[model samples]
Target: MEQREGYKRELYKHWNKGLDAGDGCDTRREVIISEAIKAPVVTAGCKLTGGSWLSPYDGVTVSDAGKLDVDHMVPLAEVHDSGGYAWDAGRREAYANDQGSPSTLIAVTAKSNRSKSDKDPAQWLPPAADYRCTYAAEWTGTKLRWELAADEAERQALLALAGECPTTTVVYGTAP
Candidate 1:
């Protein structure tokens, strides 16, 4: 557990790069995706964090990682489309590595994450009726933290979905 914690910390450091959480403006997908998969097994032996088998997407309980995916809060394509391409490999890697952080990553149902693959909120959403609010806030928080941009449609979609989870204390923060 100690070793795992150490690795998570290192990974977080690599991702953060001393930049404030919301400073990754104009990120490119080419750079981040390459780095995103480098730490592919961060939660190998660990249980999923935030929301669970009771999927916020489908409302079904997923008991295993096979049923889930560590989704990038800001999809890679969106990152690229926004401007990630101009970043150095290290920053890209760090953005991809954002998984180790609390606000940019989520262990969500395979169906939900896949359904949302590289898509902005305007393009996809969780099927679970109760999870939309948390989902929206997370989506907003992730984009804001990374300084990722959203088109008018995407921004509206997020605002609408956030109406579902009205609580403001969803615990968006750094990873342990």
Candidate 2:
């Protein structure tokens, strides 16, 4: 595979461009509002004064939206490594802001998202034991949906994780 050479974070335009653009809230805040355990008050200009969300990554219930990070199931850097480097800016932006699948973009604790940054399944898995299976499934599904290629190590790790969750279903769409 040809390397992308220099992968810049700016290559993928995220947040502020997803669903309900007219709602005054950006993709990050919008995800927070939608995933809130307790609906938050959306004041003018999409300022989320109060709300709570469950970080499935660690089962941590966060009451403040500021502490949450809207994570991509597959990080942008990781996507570049997984063949997204070949995508045009438009497709890359669409992938970054994809809310079509709930798992595509999610709200998790900043700590968890940061810790999981740019790592593939082979390098890291969710810390929450119970969430590992689901994580693997979602990770796999996201790759499949985007027609992203996983390295051998990642494929092996996913296979092992899948064995643990035989009943877990991974529903993905065709190649884009």
Q: Which candidate leads the pack in lDDT?
A: 2
What is the lDDT, from 0 to 100, of the residue 138 in candidate 1? 76
Off by over 4 Å in 1: 1-54, 162-176
The TM-score, computed over Cα atoms with residue i paired to residue i, of candidate 1 is 0.60
TM-score for model 2?
0.95
Per-residue error for 99 in candidate 2, Å, reads 0.6
Worst 10 residues of 1 by lDDT: 1-10
Off by over 4 Å in 2: 1-4, 174-176
TM-score on alpha carbons, each prediction: 0.60, 0.95
Error of 2 at 44 (Å): 0.9
- lDDT per residue for candidate 2 within 8-119, as digits (tens), equals 9999988854588688888888888889999999998888878789999999999988899999998998899888999999889888888788888899999999999888
Clashes of each: 12, 1
